[model samples]
Target: MNSARRFLLSFAACVALALGMAAPAAAQPFPLTFDAGWNGAGSPPLPASGFWDVQANWNNNFQAGTSNNVSPYAYYQETAVIGGDLVNSVGDLIATFAPVTVNVRTFQDTLGTSASSPAANRRAVAGVLVQNGSTLNIQSTGRLSVLVTYGTNGATTGLPTPGTGSVAVESGGMITIQTSGQLNVVDNIDINNGSMTVFPGALVTAQSINSGAAGTIALSGNASLTSTGSTTLNGTTTISGPNVVFNSGQVFMGDSTVFNPVITGGTHSIMNVNGPVTMNGTLRPQITGVTPTLASSWVLWDSTSTNGQFDFSDDSLTDLPDPGHRYNVATTTVGSVHGTRGLLIVENFLTAEVDRATGAVWLRNTANTGGVNITGYQISSASGSIDAAGFTSSLDDDNFDGG
Candidate 1:
């Protein structure tokens, strides 16, 4: 059966069981709580081996056993006072058998003074799989780190493939990496139809991020994501969604890499990049309904350095605003524009100008010459002007014969 159907069935079973049970004559029993440690008084300990769902060791540490599978439809609402760790010494931390929800609230522990203490052991091995509608929520005011890595074996015979054993935050559910929480994935994070929210003061680092067409990642407050590799956006997805606002923090999209994400203007939403933004793909800045003035329109690239290139090869800058409105793509230093077959259609007027003092703009055609295909380029300004400045050709034999 599908994941959604399975989750519904499991939830129904839990409700039925709760309803069938007789209520206590006095007070209701409290929910089970698991403290951070291998052994403690009145603490629900984890198991040592076998499946994690086994009831033999209910007061042990939460360890991912050799089977690498947890109980299906199991929900753990853990209020950890000293913080808990989910260690995996073997294969991937798979939750595919059933949908599991882990609500973890971590606090400061006074056990050891070293960096690697019992509180610092909140980690997993061979990556984490939240597929089949599983959800992992981590809320903390202190540090809570989880690093998903591959074993000593290579990818050929490794327990999980490099960048293959991804943390799937599938759709219809939520996986929250709250403030003071850090989750580093060695592989790609596939946000396939799921909702993953990274709150401010939290860090989520991954090799790459493949956001599905229907998946939504709400990067709000001061939350930051550092992608060591590339981030590919598929389907019809926007960087900002309802209740999703990105006002602060830097989202470093690697160095000298072309990162493309479809962006739309919303409340306090802007595409803010700190390093060089080399966009070889299309940057669809949707302009409809509202008029886009110079100050109110979207600012595509606000680079901090001079070595950035905005390549518009096979790109389309669509739905340009009406007359008297402008869409600006500005950088601090030198910014280059490449248009092999790309088109910039404006409804009124379009000015591709650069700051004459601190910066320079380069516009070149497919041959890297002054020749540009602005044949159908129409500007609603008086005289319909098309200005091409700072033109230079590398071909020694060719000459500029016409004015």
Candidate 2:
């Protein structure tokens, strides 16, 4: 009876083996979880080393929540270095539900040589969605790159559109890039919260930037921001810095634009705005030099409106006007000047004044030989009173209306 029972048991075991049911269960992939700690309620530290996308070192449960449909809340506070690409295949890579502070650096040397290499250092093919009443603090001495997008899962496969997520760089915490690093954002960037500060040496290439409604982009200490493509502005954007160079492909200012920079007269570093600029604020040219004349012609307004005018109602020149140089407001269309109001005050040491009213160009000069020469548009204003300085002013014969 015992031998029969053993034989029956062996037969059942053999059958189970043949059916592939006796094999050990496969190991579940490790989810990237940041509990209180590995032991639950201790200081959490970053993993020694691993690829950002590896399941063994990551806890996918942390990304699940009401706002994000992926993972639950996880407290993340650590500084780590990633040696591989941090690509996200799920929905927006969100870090919320906790006061999260992560200083991440990527290994650039291991990144492949191709332009589209997934292992490219400091570059994230996925979009970083920071919202839901959460703040993400990132401070990187090495190159840190991210692709800003919206509405799609944070994937590293395609271009991104503007979404609800925002990336705010905390004040004094910087993302420094060496070796000509370029941080690209496909949509508009908001710096009005005053929580983010782009340092002087950092280079960011973006499509557009909104200096929040009452925000100011203070470019102090020789900081610079260059736009690789056309950009649009929607609020009151103020430029208050010294020797700050803002290079844009084309800028369309939808609201008031203010320029209050302390620039040297002959310096080649000037603010370059390549599109139609609608001046809704006071533009004060603060040029400084020994014989500081506005010679560089820095402010270029290429307007398409035939009646486009620079309303310098509140502008004051801080330096003398150079006789040999003409401050050109280069425009495309040609017609009678209109829509101009207020005093176009170009006051100089020689006390020469050039004013542009509706369809008229008025010049009052007290200096001799060197006068204001108007070009590119027809001057239709009646002659004004000449001053006692024996100064002369000339309007281009081709653009003069003889009114």
- What lDDT score belongs to each candidate, Candidate 1 first? 0.38, 0.35
Best-matching candidate per TM-score: 2
**lDDT score for residue 138 of model 2:** 29
Q: For model 2, how does the per-residue alpha-carbon lDDT over 68-89 read when each residue is reduced to its tens digit?
A: 2211111011112111122232
Error of 1 at 50 (Å): 21
lDDT of 1 at 73: 14
Say what the RMSD of model 1 is.
Answer: 18.1
Model 1 lDDT, residue 360, Cα = 45
Model 1 C-alpha lDDT per residue in residues 60-127, reported as the tens digit of each score: 23443322222221111122211123432245342212344554454312123321221222223233
lDDT of 1: 0.38
Off by over 4 Å in 2: 1-141, 148-182, 192-196, 219-224, 234-247, 271-274, 289-403
Q: How close is candidate 2 to the true structure, as a TM-score?
A: 0.43
Candidate 1, residue 177: lDDT: 77
lDDT of 2 at 360: 33
